[model samples]
Target: MASDSEVIARGDWYPAHSSRSAAAALVPRTGELIAIGADGVALSVSVVSALSFSSRVGAIPRRIIFADGSVFETADNDAIDHYLRSSGHKSVSCAYRLEKLHPRILVFALLVILLGVGIYRYALPALVELAVLVTPPIVPELISSGALSTLDKTALAPTRLSEHRQKIIVERFERVASGAEGESYKLNFRVGGLIGPNAFALPDGNIVITDELVALAGGDDEMLAAVLAHEVGHVEGKHSLRQIYRAAGVAGLVMLIAGDVGSGVEDVLTQGGGLLALSYSRAAESEADRRSVDLMRNAGMDPVALVRFFDALEEKLADHSRTSMLSTHPGTPDRKDAILKYRAGSD
Candidate 1:
């Protein structure tokens, strides 16, 4: 109020010579700030280059900071704001801008949310695909070993199929796997228990077919052979490895978002994510089915056996809704039609 060219903020400041804080006033000059003690003792002079302002947060006091680490604390926010406006001193801090335009913060938050979704849905998968391309062979072997051991202890048990049955099935599947993924691939049998009739390919070219699936085949070697070839197709295309990386990406994304999801929702997400990984997407399933067809044709086996297998599964597991037209794996109907079209050269 002394003059239009000057504004002063009455505050408390700690002078270098003082043992404690004392009454002080910040006086703005042509292009600098000067601090004076209550008795009119000159305390500090801060040039524009060495001067900074703290963010205006609510009704909290603001600080006029200087290069020498000294700060002028003041509760006179209006005076300081007037001084900054009159002196053409624009605060460049994000906190200040955001507070000044608080409504825009919501818009900014929405943009950030959209960007995160884009990264998770689109960019993450592309990144995982690239990562899978560079993954070392040993990594898959270690992962497969650990996964098999864990399953053996939990959902899967030792196969109950007779040695004769096991031998015949293994030999037949060996023929189906002959022209794909080389000799490193092997087949194993397990009692699916509650997992139902299913087959899965490990990253390291090992395929495990549940005993329930073998029983589901009803002793038809062509159907069993087709199923094994489909799993080998998974091995040949490195689909399992892709699934492993995708699942990891999903887990990371979910963890990034799940700050407070309770056990129930988190459990639902976990189970859904597991099913997603195991299903390997409709595209991947289709690719494996095609691969299955190719491998079966190469081995002089019937390709229609896969379609028949689907029909049988749809009938047997009708109560489970697993093979429904809405579930993962393109639904049994879509897959059957696709397979038929592929075989007939109309796909």
Candidate 2:
């Protein structure tokens, strides 16, 4: 290492260049000189004025040697210390402090959160609404295509009853409902092998009367008409349709959470079919009862036949579980009350 006097004389003391690339080149001030090695060649350059450090570069102290005899030191010479101080050159610390934050990441995160919320709240509800509309209409088609086919092949085709009796029943129903409201609906009746003395109306206007139900009427035309009218009332009100839609809406929510609906749709449809086969609402049952009264009155039959038929039905069904019929049709007590009320009133 060169002595302090030699270092001062040679002006090899203060930083000759900024450590940072961004910092500007600095020259010594007047009455001072800076000795620097450039490309391995030593050179001394005299300064005419105080050297100014570039804001882009770091600060560098000056080294001076007086002509009288002593070396002048503006500041201590330490390269590591100077580099550390110059690190703040170009106002790096201040620039970093003032730097603006990128909002893109925050905005993106907010958008993802909002999208998730929309799918959960709004999108799911809309999907349920769509399923409601689609399910009702589809259920009837599925039942007609499957259940009716199964019954026709297995039960009705092999029945011992005369075909003429079946024809007569069909004709009577058609004649009575021919002029009724919603008469244009394609109405058909079939004999289902379902146990118990019961009958039911399907969503597609198909009414299934069990053999037990037929036998219970004792072949009385008026009694059969009353039963058919009540079932027809259920068809007209689309009670089965509403129930199907309700079940589908619930199934759709389950499928959505389970991921792929395509694989589960058949299972959902099967389960929904079982639910559809069960019962109608109390409000729906009442509406059907009222409709039956109207149909019987219009068909020139004593609407009181419905009351008598119900009395007979209540007796036969007493020991059986009334769950299925009661679910879709009103209780016997309610039906009896409705009949009495209708009988007392005029058209």
Candidate 3:
């Protein structure tokens, strides 16, 4: 080793004239920084200003930048530290200081992850619900139209019921719908196709009753009227729109947590948009059912007809759990039974 004052760092160097780097010592001599090679050749650099001193990463060497855009690197941090303090080079970045403290960085990273998850699981759902509640009526109409068109191509066929039956059902539906709180409804009839005997309402107040559902009633207008009233409840409560928005919000949250936001995975969330119309959460179903009871009473039909219809539908499906309450509406037997109790108490 050279004398303490003659050598600060013994490392590789690339001279201004040389295309190859060589073993050299960074030494201060005559108030200038110099690179001295083993061959006794010395090249001097006028250290006018110290630009920056970069922190070492793992076992990587440290990098030093000079004012002249020249770079110096060394793995000997002890020697480099001695040179910096002795040479009055105090220029260092906060990043360098932080890198020196590894534990703080790990704690900071963990906190950030926890905070993000908490916001997604709790705050995001409430915000989505509030936004859905405040959304304009026209937005639901636009969403419903797209969803209906998709269903028409896949699950629904043209109306198979006779004109007389369509007119009668429409007139009865109109009477109940006029008392509903939602926008004016247009009654639509279609063959249920593969969806089975079902009736569903769109966000924009289009209540579709299938031919199979009509047949299932066996020409009982009271039962069919009860069904229409229930669908009106869905429309008035904006249950379809709320369910879709909640689904979209959850999908977004999943994509965000998975680090796949703005990727093709969004298409997977939106592809079967029509299915949103078919499914109602248990809470949403309950709200609509309650509304249906009121609509039926206002239209002078017994709400008990709804309970009877549900029981009959459950029997016809053969699976007790295959009723509207379990399939998509998603309610418990207690909830199904409550409808009958509600009617009896009202009487």
Candidate with best TM-score: 1
What lDDT does candidate 3 reach at residue 9?
A: 79
Residue 325 displacement in candidate 1 (angstroms) = 13
lDDT of all predictions, in order shown? 0.74, 0.56, 0.71
Q: In model 2, which runs have C-alpha deviations exceeding 4 angstroms?
A: 1-139, 150-158, 183-191, 254-276, 323-327
lDDT tens string, model 3, 212-305? 8888888788888887888898888777766676666666776776765563333323333344335787777777777778888888877657
RMSD of every prediction: 12.9, 21.7, 12.5
Which prediction has more favorable lDDT, 1 or 3? 1
State the displacement of the C-alpha of residue 143, model 2, in Å, after optimal TM-score superposition.
4.3
Which pairs clash (backbone N, Cα, C closer than 3 Å) in model 1? Answer: none
Model 2, 228-309: lDDT tens per residue? 8888887777666565555555456555555555634353344423533556667777787777788888878777677878
Estimated TM-score per prediction? 0.64, 0.53, 0.63
- lDDT winner: 1
Candidates ranked by TM-score: 1, 3, 2
113, model 3: CA deviation in Å?
A: 8.0
- Model 1, range 1-347, lDDT digits (tens) per residue? 23324447888776544548777888866777887777777677889778878867767898887767677889988888777777777763456555777677789878878877898789998988898789888877877777777678777889998999999998888888877864388889999776768777777888888888888888888998887787787777787677667766666666676554335333322332342235667787888888878888888889767988888787787787653212435555688888888978932
